[model samples]
Target: MKALKKIATSLIILALAAVPAFAGQQGESSGILTWLFLGFIGLIVVGQLIPALVMGFGMVKGVLGHSDDHSHKHNA
Candidate 1:
C-alpha cells in the first residue's frame, strides 16, 4: 500500500509539473476581470513613474545647478 501511494503521488506531481507542456492558446477572448487587472497594473506603473520622473528632473537640476529664479535677483 505504501508503494502504491508513492506511485500515485509521483504520478500526480509529474502530471502537474508538465501541464504547460500541453497547454495551448485559449480559443476565447479574455474576460473583463483580466482587462481590469491589466488596467490596475498599468495605473500602478504610471503612478510610480510620474513621481520618479519628477524626482529625476529635480536631481538633474541640482547636479547642474541651473535655476531661473536667480534672474530676478540678478536684475536687482
Candidate 2:
C-alpha cells in the first residue's frame, strides 16, 4: 500500500509538471488573447477618461458663459 501511494504521488507530480508544458503549447491564440485583453482594458480606460475630460471641459466652458448664443438662426 505504501509503494502504491508513492507511485501515485510521483505520477501526480509528473502530471502537475506537464501543466506548464501544455500551457506553453497554447501558442498564437494565447498571445492574441493577451493583446485582445489589453486592448479591451485600454478601450475601457479611454472610454471612461474621454467622457470625464469632455465633461470637465464642458463645465469650464459653461461656467465661463462661453456658449451663450441663444439666438435662433434665421432659415433662408
Candidate 3:
C-alpha cells in the first residue's frame, strides 16, 4: 500500500511539473487580472508553507526532547 501511494504521488508531481512545459508561449503583456491570479496562487502557497513549517518545527522539537519551563513548575 505504501509503495502504491509513493508511485501515485510521484506521478502526480511529475504531471504538475510538466504543465509549464506544455503551456503556450507568453508573447503579449499580461494585464492586472493575470497579476491578481498569480498573486492569489502565491498566497495559497505561502499559507500551505506556514503550517508545514510549524509541523516540521514540532517534529524537530520532539526529537530533541525539549520542554517548556512551565511544564516543570509544580504547585504543592
Candidate 4:
C-alpha cells in the first residue's frame, strides 16, 4: 500500500511538472495577459531559486569551515 501511494504521488508530481511544457503553445493573444503570465512564471522561478541559493551557500560555507563567531575566549 505504501509503495502504491508513493507511485501515485510521483505520477502526480510528474504530471504537474509537464504542464509548463504545454503552456502558451496554442495561445493566440500576446498582450498584457502574456506579460502578466510571464512575470508570474518568473516570480515562481526566482522564488524557488532564492532558498536554493541560500542553502547552497550554507553548504559551501560548511565545507569550507567558515563561521561568523570566534572560538577564542578573552578573560579580563
Best by lDDT: 4
The window of 10 residues in a row where model 2 has the poorest summed lDDT is 22-31
**For each candidate, what TM-score against the reference?**
0.51, 0.43, 0.50, 0.48
Q: Candidate 2's residue-wise lDDT over 1-76, tens digit each?
A: 5986899899999999988887666445557888999999999999999899789878977898866677989889
Instruction: Give the per-residue Cα lDDT of candidate 3 at 8.
Output: 80
* Over 4 Å off, model 2: 1-30, 66-76
User: Against the hidden true structure, what lDDT does model 4 obtain?
Assistant: 0.89
CA shift at 76, candidate 1, in angstroms? 27
CA lDDT scores, all candidates in order: 0.87, 0.85, 0.89, 0.89
Q: After superposing candidate 4 on the true structure, give the runs of residues whose Cα lies further than 4 Å from its correct spot.
A: 1-29, 66-76
Q: lDDT, candidate 1, residue 37? A: 100
Q: Is candidate 1 or candidate 4 better by lDDT?
A: 4
The order by descending lDDT is: 4, 3, 1, 2
lDDT of 3 by residue, 1-76 (tens): 5986899899999999999995877677889999999999999999999999799878987989966667575779
Candidate 1 achieves a global lDDT of 0.87
